[model samples]
Structure formats: structure tokens, C-alpha cells
Target: MSQTSNSSSRLSALLLAAMACAVSPAVVSAQSADSATAPGLPATPTPNATINLIRLMVERGLLPAADAAKLVEQAETEATQARAAITAAAQPAPVAPPPLEPDTVRVTYIPANVKRQMIEEIRSDVMAEAVAENWAAPRTFPEWVAKYKFFGDVRFRYEGDFYPDGGVPGGTIDFNRINTAAPVDYFSSTSTAQPPSYNADQTRERFRFRARLGSEIDLADNFTSGLRIATGESSSPVSQNQSFGASGGNFSKYALWLDRVFLKYEIQPKAGSSFSAIIGRTENPFFATSMIWSNDLGFDGLVLQGKRKVGENLTPFFTLGALPVFNTSLNFGTDSTASSGGGKAYASQDKWLYAAQTGVIWNINNDLTLKAAIALYEFQNVEGEVSAPIDATTLNTTSGFIGSTDSSRPGFAQKGNTYIALRELTNSTLPGAGNFQYFGLATPFRELAATARLDYNHFEPFQVSLIGEVVTNLAFNSGDIASNGPTQLPGPRNNNSFSGDYEGGNVGWNVNLQVGAVALQKAWDWTAGLGYRYVESDAVVDGFADSDFGGGGTNLQGYTVSGNLALSQNVWMGVRWMSANSIAGDTFKADVLQIDLNAKF
Candidate 1:
């Protein structure tokens, strides 16, 4: 019984030891292989350590092999159950949901009344500020005044005229003897005579200025009115510059004259198409250069212009115009002569000009543009005529001479037209009458002109342009021009006759190349150009050609070099040089240099 008891205690002790080993950290770590795959089962135990312990126990005769195996199995089973219980305890518990309410949807928003109140508050503030700033003040003005715009420009210039010594051949003339029997001696005069010639080679300098003011107003729907006042002589069509020394020793105030006043009406029937009519001393209605017409010249008459777009990049245009170039009305009736006596006579006539043009503008690409035009211009009733007043004078040798009586001549002679002097018919009582001359327009003028321009603006802030123009006179009648006879006045054998064949057939051409910084606002902005022009005598109305070239007349060929540099946003300085020579009857040369400062507003 004592031995049995001892054996039982030993087995109990061994079982307790086995159970402690199974709960060891090593055993727990080994059993972590896969608790997920098997719910109450441990991973297969590692046999190395467990097997050694069991064998030692058996060998020491503490227990039989089968008993050791049974103890090991019991330990593993307990450990697996322990691990499963731990895993189960670590898992989350099932949660119970709260009680349900009735079905409904909820929305949160400001009330409409509150939103309206906020908007009204903002409006009231704005209105109060506007009232404080006088936004509700009543305004009174003429309806026409509200549609008007005013603009103008001013220019100051320093000019120089330089002539070489041994003056150009055929450059001298005696105005007093222009109508004498002599041949006028214009072609054979020498510059180095004992007394210098009238047009002796010399240098002259002067300061000049020009100013203009203009206004445009909308008169009615599609109708507009424009007017301009400028500083210059009323009869001068090509220049507005006034010389500083004309005051005769005092500070002289310059004269101002009407430059332009016109009315325009436009109609647009559809997109990309329009037509316009202008009347009353209007702007030049053609695409022309100074080669054909001066920039300052205005036309007095009516013009019709129209344009239409054919495609995205092409436009065609047309212009037709008529202008009254001159009007002369004069009466000669002396106090000593009866109302129906032979002394009463009259001279009256009118000159008219008509023009037509067709052109196209092509925008070749984003950077290039081209324009071309063809034009025809005609002059009518330009020839001088002999007329009789209501109470006419009988024909007499001394009475019928040009300038002999007030009825024989026009009141004013346009500056640049070729003229013939009537020396025998002069009146000593009249001042500046010793050299009276008559415009020799014995035939009409018919002209055809072609023009083209190209512009390239691909380079930023810089542009280049090439321009060309050609004009030809087609109504040349030498016979009719030469048929013009001397004055019928009886004098010392009127020796002066129309010396040469006065034909109207002539050609004029001009070409220019220019490069510049297109916008002249920034510092250092500049432009420059070189040009050549050749205009034959009678090719165009000399009074309307470039007034600064060759002393403002035709029969000239020249080269011009010009440049401008910006001084400020709306001001610039310009320099130009022109070297020109006459192309007809006499050899004449002139050089003009100009420096100008200009401002615009």
C-alpha cells in the first residue's frame, strides 16, 4: 500500500510538471502556427524538446514509454484548448442596434425671408453710396453736343534751303520782261553775271509752325458732320506751315483759315458691306500718295465710296468723285463808260474735276498685307474762255489784251500752274500789276494712275513696307496747246509766244522702302525711309503735288531720305532731306532740309 501511494504521488507530480511546461512561452510561441485554420486544435508540436524529456523520464525508470506519450498528448490537448479560448476572448462582441423611428427626410437651409432681407440690405448700402456720390443728378446738354468729338495736332519746324554756286543752267528769269517780244532769256542765262541772277545760288533758313483743330459730330442716323480750321493761306492747297518772319518786325499772329467742313452719310445693308457719300470740302476720297496729291489738299464737291468683302482675307472697294476746282467771275465797267458802252465786259468760267477708282486689299496672312488700285481722273472746262458781260465792250486792240481790263483775267492765279505774262497790258496805277500772268490751260487733263503697296509685320514692334505708284497723262493735244496765241492788245509787237509745244502727255512715278518701330510711344522708337520720285511737267496738278519738293511744283525728279525718333508718348522729332531737279524747259536743282517737332492730342 505504501509503494502504491508513493507511485500515485510521483505520477501526480509528473502530470503537474507537464502541465506547467505546456503553458510556457516557448510552447505558446510554437503553437502560434495557425489558430485560424483549426478552431479548438493546436498546431503540431515541435518534437525535439518534448521527445528528449519523455525519453529521459522513461530511461530513468520514472515512467513507461506509453505513459510518457500519454502525458505529452494530454499536455498538447490542454494547451490547444487554452489557446482557442484566448483567441475567442480576444475577438469582438456582437453589437445591438438602437430603436427605429418613423420614416422621414431632413433638410437645413436659410429661410427665403432671411435671404431676401440680406439682399435688400446690400442694395440699400449700394444705393446710399451712389446717392452720396451724386449718381442721381440730372444733366442738361444739347443732344448734338453729346455726340461731338474734337481733335487736333500741332507741329514746329526748322527748314533750310541750300543751293550750290555757279547756279544751275537755265535757272534765271526776268519776270518783268516775261511778256516782251524777247524769248524771255530763260535757257541761256549765266549765274556769274556782273549782278547776281534773280534766283542766285544761296542758302536760306527759317522757322515755321502749323496748327489745326477739328471736330466731328453725329448729325442723324448714318449721317455725320465734320469741320476743321487750320493755319495757312486760304488759297494754298498744299501747305499749312506759316513762316515766323511774315509779321514785318513785330510778333505777328498767324492767320487761320477753314481747312475742311463736310457731311457724310453711310448705309450698311448687310455684314461686310457698306456705302458712303461725302460732300462739301471733304477729305481726299482716294487711296493716293503725295506723288499724286498733297496730304493737306481737300476736295470741294461730292464723293461716293463703297466696299465689299469677298472672302475672309480679301476686300474690294470703289470710289467716284467730282470737284469744282476753280470758279472765276469778273466785271469790267469804268465810270467814264455808259452802261451799254464799249467799255463794259465780263469774264467768267468754271473748272471741274472728276475721278473714279477701283481697288482691292488682300490680307495674305497674319503677317502680310497687300493693296492695289487703278484710277482715272478727268478735268473739264479747264481751258480759258473769252466772255462778254450783259453790257459788253466793243473789241479794240488795247482793250482786249489779257490783264488789260478786269474782264480779261481771273481774280487769282493758282501758285504752281504754268503761266504767260502780258507785259504790254500792264496798269501802272495797280501795285504788283507789272508782272501779270495768265494760266495757260488750253487743253483738258486726263490721267490714269496705278498704285500698289505691300506691308510685312511679322517682326514684333517692327514693320516694313514697300510702295509704288505710276501716273500718266492721256489727253495730250500739242496742236491745241500751241494754238494759244498772245494777247490781242496793240503794243510794241508782242514778241512773246507760247515758246514750246505744250503737250499734256507726261508720266510720273514714285517708289519707297520703309522700316520702322510701328508704335511710336516707347523710348527709342524710330522710323526711316528712302524714296525716289520722278514727275514730268504737266503730269499732275502741280498745286496739289508734294509742296515741299523742288519748291512746290511739278517737272521734278528727286530722292528723299527721312527719319523720325519718338521723344515721348505723343511727340516725335523728324528729319528729311530732298534733292531735286527740274525735268523740263530749264535745268533747275534744289535741295531742301527740314527738321520737325510734332505733338498730337
Candidate 2:
């Protein structure tokens, strides 16, 4: 209908133009006058262009105004029909196309430099945030939520011991050994000049305190670094203040030492395994609570540990690594001159100690587990200075004849005239006192250890556990011997007074009881246990005369009673008492009490 209207309008415009030109002035007037009588057609023409045709006709005396209007309307109607037909013919044909929606497009790219700049900006923003909060970057945080964390342990202690004296009474003077070939003033002490007696006045009062501070940083998803400052024999160089001398003086010196500083790599296992790699100083993986014969103590090495599940109930573990052993020295004199024998006067041997080990762990059941391990440790060789004989009648004054021994060689004989031999001694023919001497090698001394541990736990109302442990020195088993030098018995062994071999085995055992949730469960969760240890060592001292020196054995047996009380999940306290018996018939005892608190942020 709309199309028809548009067509009709066009036709009317054409017709109007044509008619205005075609009609004469007189004819238009006559036609308009006859319109009323002959309505179908205009009767005459008139010059009506100046006005609308109807009005012009009326004024020209052609017809009445009303009849002229009617004729004009009829002409307009016919013209409308004609225009409709012509317009319809002139319209363009519509074209068909597949249906679709127009799509809008956008493009974007980030150049390398711009991307880097944006990253730097983000980092700066993050750094600012960290500083405002007194926090660290993501790499420094121990956990996802913590950018950085501070952790430390402080142990305040009041300790006491039975033997207030500096050392166990009646114990043999073994300082004849010195790590250095020459004397070191820094390592020597006054104790070596004169042998101290077991006088009550020399005993010491015991008091002690220890602390540790540490932090961890996460460098990446699998990498982390941790450092700790600790005070204690196990962690640091500070010896515990077990007692005070009778003179009312501290017997042990306290100092700070770095316990641990290392980077750890945690490898995410594929499905059911665990792996860890550590670089720098770390603890040796061994079963014995005490590192009786392993060199994996302190810094300077790398370690690898891995755990894999072989079966449903069996998980095997292994550790491999090398560590450097630090030698300890004691001085006997206040002067630069090294002492012939006794405590206090030597320096640690300058050499690198090497070690390596591998081990496996198996779970027999929920209540039983077992571990087997083997290790190789290399210790630096220790050499001592030799002294000449003092006189023939007074015995060797320089050798400080603490005991006496006999040798086949004339020089091995004592200088004393008619000297009475109090004790019989066993002498080894092996050279260098069977010290496994490899003097030519850059690093000569080493000791290997093999250990096995079996543990059992019974879960009833209370948790009860039993652990049995054993260790053996592989160096002894090898039967390697240094050259048995000149049989000079009365004099120091081959210019080395401290020549000797370390041979021994250790056994340790422990029984643990975890107090069940009994009447005290509401207030205290506790565990009480007892542990026992035994060490047997055979020490051989060569070059002493039968009248002055001898080699003997030392055995130590000790027991520890410990109790643990958990005030709460985050708070706990522990107490322990340890007592030991030396082969020399000396008894020593120590007691420790500790309190600890832990919290989560």
C-alpha cells in the first residue's frame, strides 16, 4: 500500500506540470465555466498558471468557484492513478543474499620493551606494598600468605651436675694427641702443664642458656633458602654450662656459631614419591642419636634425599652426601711451646674431611619399622711434637710419664734406673700405632661407619615404642696399618708423641611411652621414656716405656630418663636426667629442664 501511495504521488506531479503548460487562458476559463453542466471534463482553457487552476478559472469567468474546485479534484485523482503505475515500473529490483550478522573487530599487541616496563612497574608496586607492611617479597615468604616470617628459639636453663670439677676424675690424660704437627698457642690451655687432682675445690657450679634464630625464604615454587644461628654443641660452638668449678667459676665458654645455612630444592614427585636436594651445610642422615662415628656434622657439603613407595606398606628412603669434618684442639700450656702430654695444647689438623652415605627405611606394619644404613667418613690426620728424655734416673721428664709400657727396641725402654713397672701393657707391631697412616696423601685420615636400627611401636591406650641401634667402624674392619716405624719404645713414636689409633663400637637403645588420654588428658598430654647408651673404645699409645706408659680400654655406660608434658597443643615442657659411669670408676650426672611454645600466625 505504501508503494502504491509513493507511485501515485509521482504520477500526480508529472500530470500537474503538463496540464499547466498545455491549457490556454481562454480555454481554461471556458472549461471551468462548463464544469458544473459537463462535470466529466473541463469545458475551456484559461491562463491559470499564476494561481491554482481552480481559482484562475473562477476569476476568468469560466465557471463558479465551487465547480472549478470539483474539476480540479477529479483531475488530481486520475493523475494519482497514472503516477502509481509509472513509479511502480521505475523501482529497482531487490537482490537476495545469505543471512549474516556484521562482525566488529579489534586488534592488540604488546612490545617486548613495553611488557618489561609494565612488569617492572608491577614489581615496584608490590615492593612498596611489602615495605609498608614490613613484609618481604613472594620469594622471601615461608608460605603463600606470609611474605616473610621470623622464627627463633630461646632456652633458659638452670642445670646442675654431680661432678662440679672440670672433667671426670681418674680419667686418663689423653691429650697426648694433637691435631697439628707443631704447637699452636691459641689452642693451648693451662690444664696441660700440670695434671689436676679431683679436689672438691675445683668443682664448678652449673648454669646454662641456649637460643636459635632462623628464617626461610621461598625463591621459587620448588626452591628455598634457610639460615639459622644457634648456640649449643649440636648446633653451635658454645658448650653447655654443666657446672661451675669449686672456685666458683664457669667451666665452659659460650660463643656463637652458624648452625645451618643452605638452599633446598624440593622436586615435586610425579605421583607417589618424594625428593629433596640440599646444597651447603646439613646434618648427616644416620640412625644413631649420637654421631659416634660419622663426619656428616657441620657445614661445607651437598646432600640428596629421596623417598619412594615400593609397595602398599613399604616406603624406602635413601640419602647420599659428603661433608667436611672440623678438627678440635686443646692446649695444655700457656706458652707457645706444645706440651708433651696431658690436656690443653694443640691445634686442629688443617685438612678437608670427606664423607658419604646411603640408607633405606622400611615399614613392616603400623607398629613396626626398620632402617639400615652405611656411611663412609674421612677424618684429617693428627700429628704431635716429640720430646727428648729428661734423665736416666728420674725417668723421661719431657714425656710426662703418666703411665709406663715396654717395647722390644732399646729406645722403647724407659730411662729410669730400676723403675718398677706397675701395669702390664699390650703393644701393637703395626706402624704409626696402627693409625691408618697415609702421610703422603693430601687428605690422610678417614673413618667409615655402618649402622642398623630396628624400631617397634605398639598402639594401645598408650603409645609405646622400642628402638635398638648399633654402629661399627669400617676403618677397623679394613685392617689397614701404617708402617711400624723404628721400635723406639722409650722415646716418642717416630717423632710423633700423639700417635695412636681410634678403635671402638657403640650401642644405643631407647624405650618410649606416650601417656594416653587418661584422667590427666584434660590438662596434660605427656610422654615419659628412658634411654641407655654404651660406648667401648680401645686406645693404644705407642712409644711409652714399660715403667711409665701403657695402653688401656675405656668404657662408658649411661642412662637418661626424660619426661614430656604438653600443656596444650602449642605449649610443652620437658625434663631429663642423664648419668654415666666411666671405666675409671668416675660417675657423672646432668639434669635439664626446658619449656617451649609454638604458634601459627
Candidate 3:
């Protein structure tokens, strides 16, 4: 056994010597290549050299294949230790004064192999410490995923409404009455005639919540795509709040709707100047107050915007866009056996909105700035035309009046537009069919608006601003609206005119003053503002106006006060109150209050 052991030891020594000769030149070549490639990169072991050493060992019977692998691993480890030691020693050591005696000399020495072993020991200790501390390599993400960004906000609110005892009044119930004539009562019982009365005094309160999630993806260069999903009823284009008990019955999940999906590309002609074009269902592109368009309204179309810096403080911008409001196709041609044979058939023309705005921003020194803009919004095919009814089947059976059987209209009833039915004297051939009603729009809308804002920023951590806006409908004409309906009233056995008291008004305006932090930041940051507004029924499309004013849109005059306080960097509390009354045709009044807790991430 002793003789065998000695022989094995000799064989191991021979294997080590052979491996050294085979690996030395390859290691030097690797070092040379590494030096040429980059700084601080260690030389890599040559697999061919190591394999040759291992083959020689196995062929000569110096070691088994497995043992040869172990031997090669051990040699590589030693070489790594040697390299590390040499690299460390190459660093310049701290300078020390010469020995006090001029003839005296100092010397320190460390054996090359011993120094290399010490380095290996130190490296082993460092690796063990790292493992004990759970150190790990950083995680890696794919290139596309790295380009994505996410954002969202959550809001919880308490809303209140107050209505006076007088209730809403002034709208005429008699379809055949003109503006100059006395109006009929709308709330009277069928058997008894009573004066028109307002709704009784009432107060309502509810809790509501809104949430939105959005993501932006960097497609390439200056192009980006964005998507946002929000919680709300699909029917409302201006609100995302989900009121408690909105489901009508037991607890139900809130509805999720796509709020924005758009693509944007930015062009830079020079420093500090840019132009962008956006398309799809996107955020509002025009700079205007809620008097003309609600802040939450999204435009489904395309927008072009440009900004140019003139000198150092004067910058001008402009925006242009076109949006499709409604689309429909109908078959209104005559057919004898058709469902509406000689009856009214519904048809609608496509509606579109085109808008253009230009504005300038001026910086007057460091503490003050002024901004102003003018815009024009025009609508095409918004007016409707009613076909003459050939028989009684075309008339509204419930009211014995002409009404639209077509589902498509420029706007919904909840939007506060007055819908009139055009009719002509026609006798019913059928026994029970009443006189035909042909419902259509009696008014057309076109608006020109101007707005101005002044900002003073002298107060640190606080901001002060004043804003004003005015809008007028160029297409409004009382005579035209009054003349659109039937010229003569149908016989109710009494005298009545076909035109109700709908005299179109053309002006709307709002003014506001605000003092607060521009945005909520850390805890205790706050803001407050007050404003007054008067919106004529015809100045703007009530359907797209601010819904919170006058319980939901146009022909409203009011005052609003709002305040907000931040709870944290990304959370805030807000309160708002609005008291409003109708501008015309109605004596409606309302008070709205909202308390909100909001958070963003």
C-alpha cells in the first residue's frame, strides 16, 4: 500500500508539471488579448489548453477522466489566485520616508506563491461573507418592458345637492303656444288645471368613487402611445365617478370604460420649440374653460398643436382639431308593405365638429405672466329635418304629437337641448292613429370664444391667478327658432300656436380668482378659488358643458367656491360648492357640494 501511494503521488506531480507547461503560454496569450480589448478585464482560461492537459493526464494513466477534471479545476484556481495577487501588487503603495541613518536600508519580502495563496484565502472569505448576507446579481428586464410607464389616481367623494321649494319652473307645456302667449302648466293633473309649480324643497347626499389607470409606451424616437381606463357609467362622457347604490339593487361591480387611447408624435425644429400631432380618442386639445367644454371630455379625432418661443419670454401656441359627433345610415324611401307604410321613418345625417384655437403666453419678468386665447367651434349637419307623415301611424301614440321614431339625434335629452317636432295638417286614415308628429331640431349652434388668464408668482409656496372667459353663439336667432315648427296649430278645440316660448339667447361668460399652490405637494399644501359663471342656453353645446354646474349643463348662472389640502405628497382632500340658477326659460335653482379625497401614483 505504501509503494502504491508513493507511485500515485509521483504521478500527480508529473500531471501538475505537464499542466503548467500546457496552460502557461495560453494564459499569457489570453492576457494579451484581454489587455487589447478593455481595461480591468481578467484573462480568461483557454478551454483548448485545459482540455489538452486533461487528455494527456488520462492517456498517460496519471489520473482518471473525473480526476483529470478535478486537477484542471485546481490548476485554474491557482492561476486565478496568482493573477489576482500580481494585479494587486502592481498598484503603487504609500510612500515612506527613508531610514533615519543615511547608510541604513529597509527591505520587506513575500514569497510569490505564498502571496498568491493569501489572495485566494482573502477572496474566499469575501465570497463567503457575501453569501451570508444574501447578496445577489441585479435583475434584468426586457427592452420593450423597460420603455413602459404606468400611472393612476383614485378619488373618493361625498356629494350633496339642495333644491328649493319653488322647484323648477318656466318651461311651457303647451306645444302650440308662442313666446308672447301665456304658458300652460306642466305639472297639472289631466282632470284639473293647476298653475305650474317647482319641485318641493329637497336635499340629496351620496358617496362616490373614481379610479383611473393609464400606461404610456415609447414606440420609437419622438412617438408614443397611451391608454387609459376609468371607472364610470358608459353613458356619461364628462364624469367618471361611480356613486354608491348606482347599480339600483344589490352590490355590483363598477363599470370600467376606456377613457383615452391615443398616439402622439413630437417634432422639434429647434431648441425650446416643438410641434405635436395626436390622433384617436384623446384628451382635450384646446385651451378653454369649462364654460365651453368640460375638463373631462375627450375628443375622438385628430389634433395639431405647435409652440414657438419668440425672444425669451413670449411664446405662442395654436391648436386645430375635428371630431365626429354622430354617425348613422337610414332607409327612408317609401314602401307600401313596409312596417311604416306611409308612416314616419327615422333618418339622421352625420354630425361633425371642427375647432381652431390660437393663444399667446407672455412672461413679464420673473413674477408675472399673462395668457390669452381665442377659439371658434363650428358644427356641420347638427340640424335635423323631419319627413312629412303620410298617415296617423307616424304620430307619437302617447302624446298625439309628431315625434322622432329615429333613435339618432345630435344630442341626448339629458343634455338639455330643446327638441321640436315639425308637423303639417294631415288626417289619419286608420281608426285609432292620431295626427303625425315629425320631430327635429329647431336650433343650430356655432360658437366663438375668448379667454384670458393672469398669474402672479411672487409669493413663495403659493400662487395667485385671475381668469375670465366669454362665448357667443353666432347662429342663434329667436325668429328662426320660433318659425321652424308648424306655422299653424292643430285644432285642440282651442287657440294655440305651434311655437313654444323658446327664444334663443347667444351669450355666456365666466370670471374666476384663485389663490393657492399650483399643485398639491407635501402635507399641508393647500389651495382655494372662487368663480362666477353665466352660460346661455345657446352659447355652447350643453351636452359637452360642465355637468356639475346647475345639476348638469347649459343655460346656467352661478357662483362656485373650491378648496383643497394635501394629506401627503400624492394624496389630497378637496371641497367644492356651486349655487346655480337657469338663465332663461326656467326658474330652476340648485346647490351642489362635493368633498373628495384623492390619491395618485
Candidate 4:
């Protein structure tokens, strides 16, 4: 046998002998004798293998140390003798040896400490490779998996909507539907479409749910990509909630819509100074309240934002972005439909929004901080155009007006914006009573807004904050809209002419005060806030404003009281109440109550 092989056999024999001592001597003799020649034997046992049984017996008062030593020596002697005897029996040549007395072999007990030391050396010799190869610890995934993160949130809500008892018959006109949806042929004798309107005096209650799941991946350098999906009905930009028992709901499955997909790259030149660029359908880029942009609103476009630290406790920031509000179809006005106005092709009327904002964060003292910002939002090609005069003598108003400027009508709306007919028809050709026509926004929209917030965090877990904002529609021109005349009204108009009601304003403002935890994160964390808002007609785009205010959209004034309490980590419940009335248009009043349970991970 090789030297290494011989040594291994000896070490294995020692380990096996010690193991068999716990059994009987006869078993020790047979097992230990065969271990030395066994194929595929285990690696050397731990050092304790030599004296573990003996020490265990000693600790348990089952055997004295001296007696254990003697038993070990006796086991080793018998095992060796059996191996020798078996070898001799295998020899072909005749060889006889006098046997020892009655299968007895003399024994010399080796001290337990000495045996342990010897076995420990053998263990180190054989286990060296395993330790070097990291055999004891292993991993489950590639290192790249560490760069990805996942998140999600779910909300369940119960809400009630109440309106005043008194109002003009037929209630308030659902102008949002009138402006957003294609104008129907309400005038035709066989028309199936009716003028849509809201239930002004009715009370409504509903259950709704919202769910979202998202993931983010970190790429090389400072680049990141993210994706998210959410549940909603019709995928409204201002809401992610899907009402229960709607749209053929009989325990029907819900649909998930792509809510966010964005790529971003960022760089930090120094402490508190950084810049970033983001693109795709993403969260809003500007820091603004729901008065200007709803909490659930997402932006589709590109933005570049940066911030620079100027001296201690002061940082200035700026943002620039371009967003496509709506894209005109390639053939919006090429067909001989009512909207096409006698098959004449029209120019592109794609709507877009360009914005620029500057803001600053300043630390007034150890306990107080301030944030302020000013932003200008400009809309391009978003104004309506009165169509060319029609030939009155040979006139025929199609099902709905489809003129060159029809595409300027908003793709979505929430009411309260002034409106004018897109087609110009003379008195002789004007639609008779019961005939219908479509309308577009009366004035263009360009917003200039200023906002400020102050926070006192001296209370640590409890903080106090004041937030305020004021905005003006710089593009509003009442005189020009009036000159167009014959504006759309809320109810039936006996004459096809202006109602002499401009019903428009250019300014809006809001103020809010908050107390308690800045954010709800864990059990016992809570927050309470009270706020008031006034939005004049045409002050802000009704489609993107706070969807829960005055049944949604501008031309409203209201007070909101809300509170949130975290019931557990990553779980919270909230309650809010809003009471509002119209600033113009139809006379209306509403009260909304909402309770929500929210969870995130």
C-alpha cells in the first residue's frame, strides 16, 4: 500500500474502534477489523470521535475515566488481532501459529487526552480540501439577482356621495361625457343617444378596490428601469380604483393595465447636487398637489431635472418636461362624416404640454424648513378653431359636427370649462329644436402657479406643516370667447344663440394644514389634515384635477378633512370628507365620504 493509503487505513481503524466501544466488544472486534479494508470509506471523523463515548459515559456517571481507558485499549487490541487472524487464514501456503489464550489479547490503555490529540491530527490531514472548497456554505442565485427590487400596494374603499335636494329639473348636465365622448345624434328621429346628465339629488354608495405591483432594476452606472401594473376600470388617469359589481360583475375577473414603465439615469456631481433624466409613462415629474394634478395621475413623456446645493441648508432645483396630451389620428377629418365636415382633410391638431419649474428647499432652523416653487405650464395647439361658414341654402348638418378643429376638443374632461360650437352655422342653417351639435373648449389653457410649504419637525414623530398654492390661467380671454358667442349651456336653450352667461374664471387657490406623522409606516403612526380649495372655471384642466372634489373637476369650492392611522406595519386605514359647491355653470352641491384600507410591501 502507498504511505498515504496506509496512514488513512490506520486513522479510519482508530475512528471505527472508538465508535464500536459504545456497543459490545465482539461487535467492536468485527467492525473495526473490516473498516481498514473497506472501499469508499468516509473522510476522517472529528477529533471527538476518539473519546466522545468515553467522555459522555464519564459525564453521565456511567463509567469512570480509568475504566473507559481500559475498555478502549481492550477494543483496539481485539480488533487488531481479528484483522491479523483473518489475513493469516487467507494465505495459500500452509502457515500455523499458536493462538493466544482463549481468543484473548493483551491490552495497554492509551490516555483519552492522547487519543484525542492523535485523532485531531488525522482529521486535519484529510479534511483540508473540503474547507478550501467552501463545502460548508452555498448560495442559491446569481449575483445579478441582488440588483432587482419589487414592490406593490393594495387598497379597498367604501364611499358615499350625497347631493342637495333642490336643483333645476333634469339635474346637472354631465358635461364631462358631452365633451369627452363623441357627440351623439340626439336630434335624429331614430337616435339611440340621449344627452347625458348626473343624478344631482340622488345619494350613491359603492365598494371599490385598487391593486398595483411593480419592480425596479438597477443597471450599470446610475441607470434604472422600472415597471408597474394596476387594476382600474377604463384606465382613467385620475383613478386606479375599480368599482365593485360593475361591467357585468358576477364575480368576474378584473383586468390589469400597464400603469408605469420608465427608464432613468442620474448623476451626482457633489454632495446635495445631482441631475437626472427620465422617459416613458411614469409618475409625475413635477412636485405639485392634486389641485393641479390628481394623486393617481401619471405622465407620458420625457423630463430633465436637476438640483444644486448652495451653501449649507439651501438647495435649488429645476425641471423641464414635454408631454403629449393627445395625438390626432392620421385621418381625423378626411371622411364625409358629421365630424369631417363634408370630407375635407384637416391639419394635425396633436395636443401637447410644455412645462418649466424652479424650486428651492431651505432649512430655516433646526426645527423648521421651507419649500417653495413656481411653474409655468404651456399648452400648444390645444385651442379650438371656429370652422368656416357653411353654405346655408344647401345646408345639411350631419349627425355631429366634424370640422377641422373638432380634434381640439378634449379627449377627456370633468366639466366646468367654457365651451363653443366647433361648426359655424348661420341662423337659417342652425340646428332646429331637438337637433344636436358638438362643442370645443371656448378658451386655451396655460397655467402659471406658485406654491409653498413650511414644516416644523420639532415634535419628531409628530410634525406640523402648512401648504399653500395659487394659480392663474394666463391664456384665458373672456372677451374673445364672448365675441365667438352662442356658447354651450347646461340645459335646454329655446333659441340657438348665446345664453349671455360667460361662466368662466381664470384663478384658483388652496391652503392646507397637517399634523401628526409625516408618513404612516408602522403601528400607531397617524396623521390628520384639513384643507380648502377654490377652483374657478377654466382655472385648471378638469380632466387632471382632484377627482373626488365636487364630484370631480374645476369650478368648485370645498373643504376637506382627512385622517389616516396605521394599524400595522405596512398597513393603514384612512377617512376623508369633502363638501363642495360649484363656482359657476349649473347650481350644484355635493358631499363625499370615503373610507379606505391600504397596504404596501
RMSD of each: 17.4, 17.1, 19.6, 19.3
TM-score of each: 0.66, 0.49, 0.68, 0.73
Q: For model 1, what is the C-alpha lDDT against the true structure? A: 0.65
Q: Which digits, one per residue and each the tens of the lDDT, describe model 3 over residues 157-193? A: 9998887655543342222222112222221122145
Off by over 4 Å in 2: 1-149, 164-170, 174-193, 196-204, 232-255, 291-299, 326-354, 376-462, 477-523, 538-554, 584-601
lDDT of 4 by residue, 130-201 (tens): 566646435534558877899999999999999876543344556557666765544345456757776678
Model 2 lDDT tens row, 1-601: 4554665456446546655565567666665554445443344554333225554445445445565566576556655675787788799888895665568444479999999999999999998988777577444633554643567755455444344334444333222222112211111121134322222223333455556677787787798888876654433121321222322345656545677788889885765578998888654444443424222234466777787777776666666665543333343232322223444343433434455666677778876676766665554442221222212222212233221111111111111111111112123232222111111111122344556655555654455555444443333221222232222222111111123432222222233333343222423777776767554321111111111001111234556676766565545566766554442223322222333332211
Q: Estimate the overall C-alpha local distance difference test score of candidate 4.
A: 0.76
Query: Tens-digit lDDT track for model 1 on 531-596?
Result: 999987667766578888766656778899999999888899999999987665445577899999
The candidate that wins on TM-score is: 4
Position 224, candidate 4: lDDT: 95
TM-score quality measure for candidate 3: 0.68
* Model 1 ranges with Cα > 4 A deviation: 1-145, 166-200, 330-347, 385-437, 487-505, 519-521
Residue pairs clashing in model 3 are 166-198, 167-198, 167-199, 176-497, 402-437, 403-437
What is the lDDT for 87 in model 1?
79
* TM-score computed on alpha carbons, candidate 1: 0.66
State the weakest 10-residue window (summed lDDT) of model 4: 488-497
lDDT of 1 at 595: 99
